[model samples]
Target: MPVSEKTADRLAQHITGGFAHPVFDAQAIFRAVMDAMARPGTVQPVKLLAQPPQPLSPVAAAIALTLCDHDTPLWLDPALRQTQAVASWLGFHTGAPLAGTPADAHFALVGDPAALIALENFAQGTQEYPDRSTTLILQVVSLSSGENLLLEGPGIERTALTAPSPLPRHFVEQWKQNRARFPRGVDLILAAPEGIACLPRTTRIRLSEG
Candidate 1:
């Protein structure tokens, strides 16, 4: 079907601008994401990218612009997928292929944390190629210090803390299963208006008691 000029214009309006300087902007966002992943539970601020559709945080938009491309298969939850503006924007900017199922996605974007799909539903890379697992990008209400989860693992000197407001139901329990998968679980990037935090497959998490 041919797209009308009006529809094109509306789509364009939602398509956010990529980094001001593609190379530099991408490099900066990449570094931020990498650092967050390396130092699990640490929040890293992201430079603003194009303003994406609703439910797509500035940080999530930045990550998509920085990391996704035609080579990656992206899966958007119903909240994001149902919006043509979001689909058009992502298609125009990242050129990432949309996956039919979570297991086939290299990256999965979840706008509603409370309604997130099961962790096991996504790709868990095989032992011989553990790095191929899906990397979940979740948009949360906030990433700040409050009720937190104690994190411990390769990156922590002792233990680190993270509190992504309003996490998914049984998130800690699900994380335990994800951790038990060892070299075969999905990694995560939690995004908020302020910034982002990561929970790689190697990180260990537990609820912090009051």
Candidate 2:
């Protein structure tokens, strides 16, 4: 269903209206997300009102609310395709376009990382405007282990938590290739039901090669 003006107005009211805490508190969440993205391999927290639909956890919705807008083109994975609630909420709140392919998307919501198509399938930016590439919102298993991987570069004060997931071995390699394109590679936000983390293209990830 299309987002009616009435729904948009209500959502705007809810967001702009007063909160128990300072209004900037919500704005602060946006800053936190930006900071996290600027430096990948790091975790950040944000408050959420209600749980978002499948594939898109509450944290993802919070991120979407903070960053997406009519200007952002969103690509939803199969898990989120039929989720009218999210589609309606996004349409009502941000008026984001539901894109048909990764290459055409500004941001993508992926539920099944294993099922996601090749990374090359998405925009890799260009020589003049590498920042034009896409950003991915990936729903992962967890962010607790504190062991089992290696993350380095850009954001690291000096290497942070051991990556919590057994990311596909090929992803790191593909990212290396993507980075050669410089500024053209995709940025990423890994989210779980409990928390969220960043993996901007600038971050260099090395899986434990054993």
Candidate 3:
């Protein structure tokens, strides 16, 4: 049977690979994300789920696929935005729109942690709707290799310590400010080759004393 023209066109399109088992994979990644969010400082493992092109780590891509959707506007850092592959893969898989500015993003992905823009530049939800703030997922070298961080707040029993490598520029100072905002601040998800760790806005962060 001769293939229809529409079918032929679809077949010829070079679709970047996403999750092989979309439903199961997304569910597993989602669970990992929730675990990290709830624990605040513990790194939760996520099996490799996607193979997005350069600059977009597999873990970051999987998180985007699992958490983002058409309604969520996404912002990409300069490194990731330097090429079209990362954005194209995300848009194709998640249907998320590219936000023109960081302040407008519902979610933002940073590929270069050390050079990341200030957290305050992104969406900080108002007091009336705290959940409207931006959630940033940063691609870093490792979840366990960076400077030690002392954590204390809700979800923590007393305190927790985490070291996510190549810490963002002025992260310690920035986090204190973010915490001070209380119900209005950006939450962070640090993604590494091994897994992910979260720092919800309610969590207090400071450089650990030697």
Candidate 4:
């Protein structure tokens, strides 16, 4: 059984919808993810959608399917951690192992952004191997309805503003510290119904004065 067919078979077993066409769906999601990551702070549409269990948004689910694999350890937040169905669905589809702690995850999915674990708690990688850091996918209320954030960095020629709601408390403060880590910090992917946006470590963020 090929991975795509095998995935379809498993999708039939679960109530949640995995990609109906795994290959094409994953490719579209991958390209969307790459675009978002490359742009940093820009909202990008995820062309593919997946109906993951409660607390796991479609965009986030599509991301997990496209990016996670057997080699990437996944961490779920308390809200998602307690949801057994979420674990089973992601485990079966992505073949990613559950990480024992936030620090251990290569990719951490945060279903509840309001009470997210401290950014400092996750693996920050080392100056020698920055890619070891965790990449967080967070579900938020809206992509443009929260606190206005001004971002400037490699991706934006001048500056960009975003306002994803229900972010963890002290996010700007925490982000300043995270930014100070330079090449060793974790990157963030914010998901909402409208789509997804990113905050690569190379990007600088602050509460927009505007």
Candidate 5:
């Protein structure tokens, strides 16, 4: 049976009013995610209402709510199996298409950052429109603070602070290669239960050889 238009409108209104923050909670979430993406390996916090899947953290759910819409396609790692509750919530709230493959996704989620799949498996954007790439939302163990690594690039004045713990070797290497492509690389958002951070495509990241 076809769902009633009134029911649909009510559902839309409910989703729009989901955020507790005053006016445009999605906008605030976008700012938070952007800040984190511009500074790779940094941690930031977010507020989420739904109880995410076992491995999917609150920070991840917040990202889904803030950034995703009907236009975005989401790909979930195998570790995050279909949790009916979470799926229904996402379907109603964001209406983002659930992607079946990494390359077909605009936002690919890594429920367990430590067990993230090979970076090569995902899309790397095209030569013409490099910015047409994916954004990976990773859920990390804990936000590790105190580090010597200096972050410098867009959204960064001279330098910014980053955690000491290095990302997986493969992830780092793939990112370096992606950077060389310029404009044609994936963005990243590392989220912890406490905070969230963004590493946009334009950001330049280097390991402290010290």
Candidate 6:
């Protein structure tokens, strides 16, 4: 259906600024995201090139604008999906299709970490095509150094410690199950006002010792 002029104007009003230099900005953000994913639990700052809607953080907005496109199927959490302005702005800016279920989403945008659905609910690509698994972009309260969890994985030469902002109940237990999926699990990008952190499927996580 064709959007009315009034609706278009409203969507446009909330459409935040994208990369000043699309190529360069996207490359920079992509690199940052890649680096964070490579080194799990490390916090990295993503420059806010765009001003997204109310519930979307600068970091989360940057990720969506950088990674999402017509080919990607995005799923918004209830909080974000409830806002028509956010949906319209995303449609106008990214042209990414909205998925009806988590399993269908190539990317899932979650505004409230505590309210996020189970990791198992999303697509966990087949062993033959693990690259097709879903990637979650979660907006959290903060990302700072506090050393609440220990991380060990391919990227870290030794164990690394990190403290992500508060997460949903039973997150660690859920993570263990997600990790058990091996080559077929979802990856995560946790975005905060300060920066973003990654949790690739391969990373081994455990609560820190006293």
Q: For candidate 2, list the clashing residue pairs, or say none.
A: none
Give per-residue CA lDDT, model 2, range 61-87, as digits (tens).
666766677998998877777766667
Q: In candidate 6, residue 9 scores what lDDT?
A: 72
Off by over 4 Å in 6: 1-9, 145-147
Q: Give candidate 2's error at residue 60 in angstroms.
A: 0.6
For candidate 6, list the clashing residue pairs, or say none: none
Better of 3 and 5 by TM-score: 3
> Highest TM-score among the candidates is held by which one?
1
Supply candidate 6's per-residue lDDT for 120: 94
lDDT of 4: 0.88
Worst 10-residue lDDT window for candidate 3 reads 8-17
What tens-digit string does per-residue lDDT give for candidate 6 at 1-210?
999999787766666556678788888888889999998877788777777767777788888888999999999999899887777777778899999899999999998878888999999999999988899998888765433878898898899887776576678889899999999999999888777789999998888895
Collision count for each candidate, in order: 1, 0, 0, 0, 10, 0
lDDT of 4 by residue, 1-210 (tens): 467986776565455589999999999888777788889778887654798877788888999998999999999999898977789889989999999999999999998889997999999999999999999999887988898999998989899999998898899999999989988999998888888888899888899988
CA lDDT of each prediction against the hidden true structure: 0.86, 0.69, 0.88, 0.88, 0.68, 0.84
lDDT (0-100) at residue 207 of candidate 6?
A: 88
Worst 10 residues of 2 by lDDT: 13-22
Distance from true location, Cα of 137 in model 5, Å: 0.8
**TM-score quality measure for candidate 6:** 0.92
Question: What TM value does model 3 have?
Answer: 0.92
Q: At residue 31, give the lDDT of candidate 4.
A: 79
TM-score per candidate, chains pooled: 0.93, 0.79, 0.92, 0.92, 0.77, 0.92
- lDDT (C-alpha) at residue 144 in model 1: 75
Q: Give the total clashing residue pairs for model 3.
A: 0
Where in model 1 is the C-alpha error above 4 Å?
Answer: 1-5, 14-16
- Residue 35 in candidate 2, Cα distance off native in Å: 2.3
Better of 4 and 6 by lDDT: 4
